[model samples]
Target chain A: MSTLENGTRRSPAIHAPGEREITFGEAIREAIAEEMARDQRIFLIGEDVAAAGSVFKVLVGLLDEFGPERVIDSPISEAGIAGIGVGAAITGMRPIVDIMFGDFTTLVMDQLINQAAKTHYMSGGKLTVPMVLRTTLGASRRSAAQHSQSLHALFSHIPGLKVAMPATPYDAKGLMKSAIRDDNPVVIFEDKMLYQEKGPVPEEEYTLPLGQADVKRSGEDITIVATSSMVYVALEAAEKLDSIGISAELIDPRTTNPLDTGALIQSAQKTSRALVLDEGYSQYGVTGEIASVIADGAFYYLDAPVKRIGAMNVPVPFSPAMEDLTIPNADFVVETAKSLCG
Target chain B: MSETNDTNPSITDLDAEHWLQAYEQMVMIRTFEETANDLYTSARMPGITHLYIGEEAIAVGICEALRQDDYITSTHRGHGHCLAKGAALDKMFAELLGKEAGYCRGKGGSMHIADQETGNLGANGIVGGSAGIATGAGMSIKLRGTDQVSVCFFGDGALGQGLLYESMNMAQLWKLPVIYVCENNQYGEYTHNSKAAAGSMVGRATGFGVHAQAIDGQDIRTVHATARLVIDRARKGGGPAFLVCNTYRFRGHHVGDIDRPYRTREEEAEWAKRDPLTLLEDWLLKSKQAEEHVLERIKQEVKTAVDDAVAFAEEASFPSESEVDQHVYA
Candidate 1:
């Protein structure tokens, strides 16, 4: 299927007209609601998750459907909330803890990094923390330093945790369902900028397996590995490069920890050039790691060194002009691809 | 110095069998810590260990009040809790020695021992780390409609952490079945609780509207009696309770913390006078519930069990290198 101008693909007309389109936020909500309905053990807990329905309105109807017991409203206690999720998961209940902002992950580091990530291993496979930590990433909403950050790299660095960054509505719904079913702790960082972005999602049941990369588009000239919100930018860049006779392939590796290194390397070998993109800081970030992996795996086949673009190593400024300069854009990707082709 | 009153359990409330059993567990714990200390001093044990020599009664008493399947989260100094909760002696010793036969298959050593079968949710190295885990267990119990109670065993040192308060707030608000048991050994590491904590321990729990009480931890009868009341209340939906057990540690913080000038010799001698094992033995004899020979026989039996456990741990094998990367995820 061909991609639209905005880089979102058009779903084949297999479903009813009214049931075809859904937003990224709706897809996430639908996934949780469906999972909670299927499994009585699944519960939601966070600040303003119930009644208030989240500040972004992602969980607007969950409280009404599940009630207060399944949909809990917790105080502004990030560490305690994450610890509760870990504990509940270890015992039996599958809890989806809503961390309102991704930047607030700093507050829950001890519980997430030390406790949740170590329980299964330290207990020697006796205890399993089957939990999901849902939070927002990306930095274009003018939310400023403390509220705006792409902290997926922080969780990805830890071994026990599985990190997922879904770039579309279909992937968002499918990946969330898979995360709930995973026996290990999974952190899903939803790009805050893509919450309302619309795409087609089937009304039928489906789940996307974690650690698998999806090819958004295939081309023979160059390979582009993008994550989360960067997938759209890469897609737009691919279209622009196609018009200029420079072909580009786009691959979205939904999960970072169990990265699809084989697919990434194979794509790099086929294209003979590769570029990695992420919304996190450039230094010691996801892009750097992926680029290193591609360079190592496709060293003999590569025509040029693998390049990476990430958010500038600085706190996201409040001003729109300064903020736009921090993250990767389609124009930058196009220019980078042109240089690599030359 | 004891907060126990006539309301607490006397020899009349509990029967002779329980008295003998409590005495047996206290003696076992004292012997275990002493043996563990000997292992460390002789350089036989691999890592450092925190002794639970003087704090036997509290663990035995509270655990006796819990059901076999009820949950309990422990602290750094946690050998007593594990044993009192019914962990096998051989496996516990194996865990300490990092043997494959250990409770955690040698993955967790002394500080991180976890026995799921015994409802022991692992001992934490971080101070006050298990507060939320314990509270979350209570939440799960409530959601699942179980009558089980969750006991969170921390130290007076944990009162310095904000997590305990946050957990206490939720446990109280949601009316979760959790008991926050603070083993107030009068010291938080090197500093005394008086210097470390700002307000009273009970006051902090009461600030969250949690049912709070203080009891003499050296007396197993009082600890058992108070724990029963609180655990029963929480199970019946009375919400969370905070218990400050006024106990003392007979040895230094860890096996290596010798020449400790944190407390004076006079203070240690004073607290040692109320050694929990001695207190129970004396009570057992005076009440005529147990004969002196019977108590002596119990101690001899405990000594055999401890010796056998040490031998088992010594004979056990270390985990293979192939298992190094296993169990990182389920």
Candidate 2:
């Protein structure tokens, strides 16, 4: 084994290329570590990012590898941290500001919407805010109300911001590097439940461009578009549908803003039917956004109405059964896909 | 402790040229704001404008202490700060008129004018919005190992914002080089400062362990001297400092806010007696800094500059409809 720049152990070069299975949290940590080692200007600032290594432990081992200066732990100030990220990015620094929970974005509406999103445009392109705001979303572990939410649709509505939601470890590592190197502001929403989910990630460095959608499964009957944690549920639903007679195609929109509408529209046209699944509220959520995109682009080719499945409108409850019913699971997707295929 | 002595001795120690420049900058700001008022009255300018007429000393003095590369964040009433930091008069007028030659290409009006080359980050419409930005700029300076200092210019209304305390705590904790200048103009829009704020402005900064001071904002010399000391300390790695300027606004909050419902005529008249311009003029003549004719010539030069800017703005065209969607992203 060889040591990485920050003293992390890595496997030596081999004649044949191979993939290593790692958790999504490990992939995110690797991306941040690699980027910081490459550029001294890149730093992490957030609540409990240092000693606690973040609430989800996604940032574990980063504080030790890089000193305190690079791994900064901020006070409980979301607005201040967001504004500071914008300010530092404009001046000369690539800051990855971590907002502990996605629902807390309400506290930083002015900083993110008014300041970061509009600074580049308001400056007439004179200033660029090259920053990444990382936050966690989704509900499953019984964390109710303020702790659980999937609010990517709110961020996608705002211009001048790029939204990324990586479902797998491969996409998590690749998309994060792209976000850090991006010239404009990007918001990365990580699913809380997917942190421990294992997936194959390459040993070599790689990056996935923003606005690109990945087609996880191919089918001729129907298309299912999902985001974040729902992407994994859609793939699992596809497996169940294949055992039956129905074949379902799965599309994961890794980046919500600057969306790959072309890929989505093509899939919808080929399948002639589409079902959008989201963990956010059904009304005015990512489901509606995807349904509209397909309606506008592939309306002629569509053989059936585009259906959508999203979380219940009510707030996530504390009980396990209620919370499970609130968030869409593989069973829900399977039922919805069977209806669409029929 | 002699009452007969000069309230601030450092005011008399400045060179003749320094006094003249400060006096001219204050005059220029007055002329620019008065012209903007005239344009608004005649319906020649678009959108509402917040005049920095009486609080010119705060912007000029704090900016004078900063170098060309030092960073500054401004509030909605930011024209004075932009001018003091070396923004072009014609471009500022063009921006107010929503013309194509404006600093933000007619996209950002008077409230959002910014000159990055001069280190003047764009003015914000939200109160206390720039506090965190200034703190982050200080963090950037520390990370880059630069001796540059950042100044955040906000009003007393912003004192209640959580961002101010949050940013101050971080800046103090990291020992970042920043100066927080609160231009207390006695009003937050229509409400008086006393009715809206509690405790003391100095107490807020001191609570964060930052060095805080309050000075006479009407006296440009005093403002200049105090700003010089605080800005010097910050640049020398002394962390953040807060300076509160006791000032007032002569006009209403915005151009259309004519009726003085929040304040009385007599109260306005009393503050008008300590007009920053008249106070600076009295000091200049009493200190023998310049003759009457010299001051008059400087006034003429400023008037001509303002007139030229207005004419240029009148002649400049509005941005084309095709470019409306441009500059939304980098």
Residue A71 in candidate 2 has what lDDT? Answer: 92
Docking category for candidate 1? medium
What is the C-alpha lDDT profile of model 1 across B89-199, one tens digit per residue?
A: 899999999899998888989988888888888889889999989998888998999999889999899988888988999999999999999998988788888788876
Candidate 2 residue B47 Cα shift, in angstroms, is 0.8
Q: Tell me the number of clashing residue pairs for each predicted model.
A: 0, 0
User: What digit string (tens of lDDT, one per residue) describes model 2 on residues A1-342?
Assistant: 122336332222121346677878999999999999999989999999999999988998999999898899999999998888988998989999999999998888889999999998887778889999999889887888888888888999999999999988888999999999998999999998888766678888899999999887788999999888887678778878889988888888899898999999999999999999888899898899999999999999987899999988888899997888888888888887787777
| TM-scores of all candidate predictions against the true structure | 0.97, 0.96
In candidate 1, how many Å is residue B228 off?
0.7
Candidate 1 iRMSD, 1 decimal: 0.7
What is the DockQ of the complex in model 1?
Answer: 0.78
User: Which digits, one per residue and each the tens of the lDDT, describe model 2 over residues B1-330?
Assistant: 001112452643568888788888888999999999999999999889999999998888888888999999999999999999989899999999999899988888999998889999889999999999999999999988999999999999898799999999999999999899888888999998878888778878999899988788888888888888888899899999998888888899998888979899998999999999889888789878888999999999999999999999999999999888887777
Lowest lDDT block of 10, candidate 2 chain B? B1-10
